[model samples]
Target: MFAEEFVVVDATSPLWNAARPFLDIALRIEQQDDSYLWHGWNKASIDAFLQKLPPHCSLMLGVWQVDAAQEQETLWLGCICEVVDGAVCSLRTFVALEDSRLPAIAQLEPGYIHAQELIRVTKGQVAPVAWALFTDKTTWDEWLLAADADGQPTDKGEALAALARQGRCVLLGSQVTHHPHHH
Candidate 1:
C-alpha cells in the first residue's frame, strides 16, 4: 500500500490553486462508475480491508468490466484532488469485490485498505492531473528533491513538466502486498 501526506500550506498555495482546475474533470470520471458505492465512513472500512490483504498488491482503477452493463468502478472517490496539466494528482482506483479474485469486502483486503488510507490522507483531494502508470524511481526521486531558486520545488506545474521530460512516472494506486518472511 502507498501512503502519502499532502497538506495545503495555504489557501492560495500553488498546489491548492492548481488543484481546482481538475476537480470537475476528476468528479466526472468518478461519476462514470456505478458498481462502486460511495460511503461516508471510508476510513473504518479501509482499515478493516487492509488487515486482510496480501503484500505487494496494488489497486487498479478505471478498469472496465467485460459486461458493459456493469458500472465503471470508482477508485479513490471523495478524495481531495489537484490538477497538473489536465491530470488528476491521484491514480489509484477502488476495484469492485466482484471484479477481483480477492475475498469478500467483509474480509480484510490490503488493496482496499491502502486505497482507503489514501482517501483519508487526501480527504478526497486529488491532484488535478493524470500521471503515467509506470514511472522511474530515479526520476521520481529527482522530482521530489527538485527545488527552485528560492529552494522551493518548481511547484506542481514544473514537477509535471519535469516528469514529462524524463519519462512517464508510473502511478501506483494500489497497496504493495507484504510478503511473509520464510525462515
Candidate 2:
C-alpha cells in the first residue's frame, strides 16, 4: 500500500463522517441470476442511508445469492466507495469488457458475500468520475482532462455537435412548434 491508498472503511467509523462529502457509491446486486446496478446513489439517497446506519453495520455495496428460484432472499455486501471527482484521478484496476471473469448477472450463482471495499482514499486522491465514466484509466484521463479554454471537452464535442446539427439530439415530442402559424 502506498502512504495513501483507497480502501473501504466502516461507514459508521468517524473516518466516514469526515470524508462523506467526497464519497460516491455504486451499488450492484444479483437477484435470481439477474444482475442489476443502481449506478451511483444520488445525494439525498446517500445522505438518508448514512443517517440510518447503525454503529457497525455493513454498508451495502452489492448482493450475493445463496439459493435458486425458490430462494428470494438477497444478501447485501459491506462496502462503500470514496472517489476523486474528475477525469485524471487515482489509479485503479479495470476488468475489460471482454474479460471472461466479468460477472454476467444471469450466470451468477447467488448466496454468497460479494463485499468489495474501495481502497481508502482522501480528498483529491482519486477521481470518482473516472470510475463512473470509463473502465480504463488512459481513456478516462484523455477525455476528462482534455478541456479547452471554454471548459468543453477536446475530443467529444465535435461529434455530438455533428449529431445535433443533423437533428439527432431532439426528441419528437419536443420538435412541435408551439405557434401554430409558424408551421
Candidate 3:
C-alpha cells in the first residue's frame, strides 16, 4: 500500500493494535510482477524512512527490487495508516525510489508516468492517489541556482521552499492530484 496507497502509519491511531496482522497481510500480497520480485529491503529507503518517522512509531514494511530494464534499484515502503476508518488501507507505500535515490529533475515526467501506471498495473487497490516526490540533491541545488541564485524566490521557487524538508534537501514535493478509478 505504500506506493499505491500512501498509507501513513501513526502510532497514535486507533488501529495500532492491529499492526502485526496488518503487516503480515501486506507482506503476503505480491504487488510486482513475477520477474520484478525483490529479494530484500533497500537500505537507503529504510534510513530515510526512519529519519522521517517519530521515535515511537518507527515500525514499517520495506521491500526492494532491481528494475533490470531501467537498471534502477527500486524500493517501496509502507508504515501502514489510520485511513479507511480502519478499513480501506492497512498498509501503504510511502516512498518510491530508484537507484536508491529520488527521481532526478528531468526524470519527473517519466517518473510520474511509471508511478501512475503502477496503480493500473497493481489493480487499483488504493483510493485517490497522492505523492510527495523528493528530487535528487542535484535538482534541488539547480533549482536554487536557476530560480534566482540566493535572491527573492518566484512562485515555483516559493513552492520548493514550502516543500523543503530536512535542511531543504527536497525539491519537488508535488502531489499527483489525479484520482485513478478504484477497481
Candidate 4:
C-alpha cells in the first residue's frame, strides 16, 4: 500500500479550473440556489501518483466519490486514485472546461514537496475548496514588486516573499531569504 492521498491540484497543475462545476462531473452550469455540482479529472494529481509507483507493478485505478459544499456549489469532484499493494498511492483529478484558456496555477512542475502539500491542504476537501486562486502574470508581477524600486524587500515584501516561499511563485528565487528592511 502506498498510503498516499489526494492533492488539491495546486495552482501550477494544468488541471485547475476557475469556473464553477470546475471538475468534470455532471451538474448545472447555472444554479438557482446559487449552487452547482461538478465532477472532473485533475491530471496533475495522476501524474504525481504515477511517479511513485513501483516499476512493473500492477496499478488499480478507480473513482473516489467526494460530495460536499464549496462556495456556491454543492459539488462532486470525480477523483481517481491508484491502488498499489492494496493501499492508495496517489489521487489525481479531472476537469473539463468550455473556454480555450484553461486555468493557471504556480506549479507547472509538481515536485514531491509540492504534491505532499497539496494533499495536506486539499485532501478530503471538495469542489471550490480544492480549487486555488488564479495567479496570472500581472498579479504575480505585483506580488513580486512588493519590494522597493531598488528591489529590496519591505514589510509587504516579506509577506509576498513568504507566499513565494510557500510555492506561490519562483520570481523571488535567490532573494527569498534576503533580509527585509526594518526600522
Task: Note the Cα lDDT for every prediction shown.
Answer: 0.33, 0.28, 0.35, 0.32
Per-prediction TM-score: 0.24, 0.20, 0.25, 0.19
Please report the TM-score between candidate 1 and the true structure: 0.24
lDDT of 2: 0.28
Residue range 46-161, candidate 4, lDDT tens digits: 33433554432222111111223531211222233334444344445433211223222221222334333333333233211221222333444455344445432245434544
- Each prediction's number of clashing residue pairs: 42, 12, 6, 16
Whole-model lDDT, model 4 = 0.32
Q: Candidate 2, which segments miss by more than 4 Å at Cα?
A: 1-40, 61-108, 112-183
User: Which wins on TM-score, candidate 3 or candidate 4?
Assistant: 3
Best-to-worst ranking by TM-score: 3, 1, 2, 4
In terms of TM-score, the best-performing candidate is 3
- Mind giving the per-residue lDDT tens digits that candidate 3 earns over 36-70? 21222232322343344322221222223335699
The runs of at least 3 residues in candidate 4 whose Cα sits more than 4 Å from the true structure, single-residue gaps closed, are: 1-121, 125-132, 157-183
- Kindly give the stretch of ten consecutive residues in candidate 3 with the minimal lDDT sum: 54-63
- Per-residue lDDT over 1-183 for candidate 1, one digit per residue giving the tens place of the 0 to 100 score: 113432322344323333343344435434444333222212233234434443323222211112236632212121132333222233322221223433332332224344344433333333212221223334434554454554321354346454654544334433333335343
**What are the per-residue Cα lDDT tens digits for candidate 2 across 1-183?**
011444543455333432343344222121111222232223333333334433222221222333457754332221233322211112222211123433442442222221111211211232221111111222323432444565322334343233334533321111122333221
